[model samples]
Target: MESHERIQAACDFLLQSPPGEINDVLNDVRNIISDDELLQEGIVPALKRYNLAQFITVDVPETNHQSIISEAARLSTGSEDEESQERWLDPRSKKSFVFDHIALEASDPQPFEPNEDFETFRVALEKASLNYLLAHFHDGVSSAFSNQTTPNQFILQVVANKYNPTNFWSGRWRSEYIVDLNDHTIKGTILVNVHYYEQGNVQLSTTHSISIALPPAIVTASPESAGTKILALIETEEGKYQNSLNDTYHEMSEKTFKSLRRALPMTRSKLDWEKVLGYKLGAELSSSKGAFTSGFS
Candidate 1:
């Protein structure tokens, strides 16, 4: 086994190297650490695991042939006619070169300088909301989901962020409980946006903004209880909307039927349904009955 000091020295050298010398540092690391140890310590295992052969390499060209004696003497004497200028190697002259690193257009890496600000009270509610769903909410067919990313990067945020979460790339019915954390017994609008698009131009989506006050004992309640309560609140809001929509549809149907019955557009008169119903009822009742029950035939 290698000594601890030896490993420490090697690691220090690697960490000390500048970005320009990273490739050379990697080589040095390989030489200092045996292949087996390298694999154990996660140095070379990446290459083996991926079955990788090709790699990006910085330019390391061979030295050019020596210039003629006259040319060498002139360079040693230095040029006096023109000012000195920076020189650069032309990539086209080289045998081969790698393409520059690939990057998507308009893509910006996430910033880390501003240490993630965790809203203590807000996060508590968010966690509680998630927990409540996990512990208590159970739909026989549909399942619930919370943001699987880091706690700092959840869908529920204290303030609106400039972002466009592309949810339509995936197609399916999904119910996610996202918190809108706030400081109150009454929480902010929890979101249940059911969105999806499929082939054949079929699509469906709806955003359910639910608001509710937590139980006095929610803080004392278990996470599961809290999340479940959140879900319950969402369901309650949905139920209210469902009833409202149904009532509206009923009213609309009644109004439409009345308008239809009032008069025909071209004929401007209602059908004589009294006489028609009278004939229909008389015929229908005596359709298969005897003379005793058949009246006014």
Candidate 2:
């Protein structure tokens, strides 16, 4: 029989056999089709059609060696001299080598969306949104702290008060998640608008926008396995959540104070400062962490 006909017969036999017998049938077929070239030309397409591409490797040739070398040389030297670059650009040059034995592992030929179930996609988006929100809050706090003047207790108190974790815990922010089916990414954003009266005359406002991109692991995982993987990630980070919250709050307090110094320079030491800012911040962070955990769970 022709190589193609034999491969087709093997595929048909395997499809009709019980699931437990597939491995035996595959081994038998592999023994019969001993030639790698014949197997690539005949059996590879059949395996892909059966969703068994992962079981085989096919040798494919790389035809663009000249382009690859030219591009590499151009990038390495950052040079545009055409005459000096002709050696690497010539395909027939004896100095150039062709990568003819490129072996490609079989992968799912279908698009990523079809491989993923909707539930996994939704879970990935939720995770992405939560991560974005927390990261944004953390960065804002860090930025505020880094820009503040040291040893200024009044500024620290003012910043802590203005960025109270309650603002986030109270659900006053806007967030949205988008699943890009084509690109296999979960994109999310968290937005917060802060408006405060500084010195009783000027109203200061700023908008904080945080964005995140999540991988396609959850979406591409089998429905039965995706939830377990997500749970594992959360459990791994559970113990550190509260500590992270506290550190973020500390940084935010410093940042807020710096902003206040620039906006209300004369009132920095004159404003009625809250004496128990530390206690209030701790309580707010604890509350915010609880809210975040509950939402993620």
Candidate 3:
């Protein structure tokens, strides 16, 4: 496949995986940018864009290569340029030679001090860094999703209420599961819910119940797994645009979806959905990890 397609696939895969799997992401990056352009253009540019090159400090002073090349070619076919600008060897490989030049240029590199205010340069650098990091982060996320090795299940729940006695209300539900390939262990799940209002007066509403159960291994692994399971159960049953009892709800929960759009490095950082639900239901778990109940007053 083309580079863009490969990148896209990797991203879709990462949505199901974790970002901490760096090796897998790097491999996917290699596939997206082959050896020819990968090193010079793709990898180099990506690193620079992400400010990694700055951190690595790849700059150094120029070296006099005239005598070194002359000595190496005492009886060889290689020739040195007048000022040794064109080609030179220092017992380092050809790649190292290029690397040295890049480092030299980067080291003490000229800053864009075009008589602008201090904040200007700071803002520009921040924007550029953000752009590069975002692109690389996206690619990394995709690669992580594709390398998932866990098995999972999804469950959804929908709940709705109407204040008036005669009006109709709607609710939508959705859920997703990332399944592990090895040992059929569940990795994670994303859940969503939505509520819609109608014009007429109505009171009382129905709730669609859903229950998802992961294997014992997955449930006991970490809190993230537990959160994913809870999300799946709630998302499976959301509100329908309109309910005639037998009618299907094509719409899924979309509210607050973007709030959780940020990516985490691993499943262990997944939100504690149990605490959230517990607070919602007002359960009396005093000893619970009530992180989710802090500001819900």
Candidate 4:
């Protein structure tokens, strides 16, 4: 399928569909495409490129002091006697017992904490998983575009108010370098970026370029599956058109992946585009003049 067709398919999928229809779209496309590379990379990445932000909320079980200890004992110990002994002797163990609700507040695009407890620590895990999905989507797309796996040169830039200046907090300010220790009202912005080159050179575009914005969240549920869930949504053509796309996706993914591997590595770095580029990818975009132009100026 041509790039134009792909773009049209994406727009159609997004336009008429309600904001809550991510799951059906995913399933509809999933049936049409069999290859994993085509499904993940070509399809999903395309959605993100079109300025979609997926929002999902995970239901976390809140615990108190007693419940935390009980749950920990149930998880860590096999025998009942061992659990009892550990609970009796461990002070830190006692602290672990009382887990409660964690608050993630969006204040100043950062996670702030006035008071923190063990219940709030789970936010770190959630953030990590969210980031992991973002990474996975990128990898899936890069691999699909090219036949080979490419090193993720994409840098995740995140801005938050809380940082550790204390000597003990050294190196903890960076993503993956440090973990989010508190869950109290966590709010922040994360930007994922990558560099694109064509035929061993940057695809310099004096006339037209591409940019992206945050995508909205798509929620899905199944009575047979894990109940309610939210995840990144991707779309593809249906029936014959869908089959054609799958074929193109398979072929293109191999070539794209191979090219990516041979080309320059996308170094892991982040940039604040709003500040550095003086423009947002989606909000401010324009097209080159019609094909009547003779050549590149």
Candidate that would win on lDDT: 1
lDDT of 1 by residue, 1-297 (tens): 465555656555554333123355657766776664643355322322211111112222342211111110111113443312211111112122111221101111111121225333334445554444355344111211222333422232211111112432222112333443332233323222222333432222334455465565654465556545655675576568657757865986778656776546577665577698886888877865766556646
Give the Cα error of residue 218 in candidate 3, in Å. Answer: 55
Superposed by TM-score, candidate 2 places the C-alpha of residue 170 at a distance from the truth, in angstroms, of 7.9
Residue 211 lDDT (model 2): 27
Enumerate clash totals for all models, in the order shown.
Answer: 5, 3, 41, 27
Q: What shift in Å separates residue 234 of candidate 1 from its native position after superposition?
A: 2.2
Off by over 4 Å in 1: 1-141, 148-176, 180-208, 260-297
Identify the runs in model 3 with alpha carbons over 4 angstroms from their true place.
Answer: 7-28, 31-35, 38-40, 52-54, 59-297
Q: Which ten residues in a row have the lowest lDDT in candidate 4?
A: 139-148
- TM-scores for candidates 1 onward, in order: 0.28, 0.23, 0.17, 0.19
How high is the CA lDDT of each candidate model? 0.36, 0.35, 0.31, 0.27
Candidate 3, 100-154: lDDT as tens digits? 2223231221112111222232233223323432542221110011121212321
The C-alpha stretches of model 2 lying farther than 4 A from their native spots are 1-171, 194-216, 223-297
User: What's the residue-level lDDT of 105 in candidate 4?
Assistant: 13
Stronger candidate by lDDT (2 vs 3): 2
Ranking by TM-score: 1, 2, 4, 3
